[model samples]
Target: MRLLPVGTTLFVVLTLGACSPSAPEVPVGADGRTDPVLVQGRDLYQANCVQCHGSGGGGGRGPQLNGGTVAASYPDTAAQIELVTNGKGAMPAFGGRLEPAEIEAVVRYTREVLAENG
Candidate 1:
């Protein structure tokens, strides 16, 4: 059996860890270009939502939105939109910081993209 040197094994492990995959990317448009709204949504989600909701919407400090949870919870998109616009309990409101359209984009991203993944 061949044994790797300690430093070499450590280097390999570190490299592999660095190469670990991130969450799946949002799908592209029929034109082969990424949807602008989804792109904006993803950026907003990473900046605002990732802290509480896991990158994949698997939930951390926040409730899980993945695996169709968001859809099930708020069958009416407007309800979710309202919740995001108006702060609820521990969840801080984004309405003051973000434009209504931007809020809508993020909501769409969560329901359509992140929710589908986990």
Candidate 2:
């Protein structure tokens, strides 16, 4: 019998661990039906914002957006729209990349879903 190298063994273990089954899915809303707006928002956030804000908007390369942080910063929906559209500080401007409606949807998702979750 031949022994596997340490690096190869570690890689195999890690790969197998990653292939393990994921946790069960939970209903998104009280009635077990997710809101369309939230669904849209979630999709948009995942596509455009997840890289910086994290999967749950808990923050990563970007500032924390959960737990009323967004609400406190941008009290008005319009203000939130501006921030997300125009961007600020280290954040990149998305105004040109996304349409107005898309921006609104993402903001709604951030405020309604992400904030509420926190």
Clashing pairs in 1: none
After superposing all C-alphas onto the true structure, candidate 1 shows an RMSD in angstroms of 4.3
lDDT of 1 by residue, 3-96 (tens): 9999999999999997753444779878998888988998889888888988888888999878999999899999999999997999999999
Give the candidate number with the greatest TM-score: 1
Tens-place lDDT per residue, model 2, 15-41, is: 999775321122378887877766777
Candidate 1: regions farther than 4 A off: 1-23
Candidate 2: residue 103 Cα off by (Å): 0.5
Each model's TM-score, in the order given?
0.79, 0.71
TM-score for candidate 1, please give it: 0.79
Give stretches of model 2 more than 4 Å off. 1-33
Worst 10 residues of 1 by lDDT: 17-26
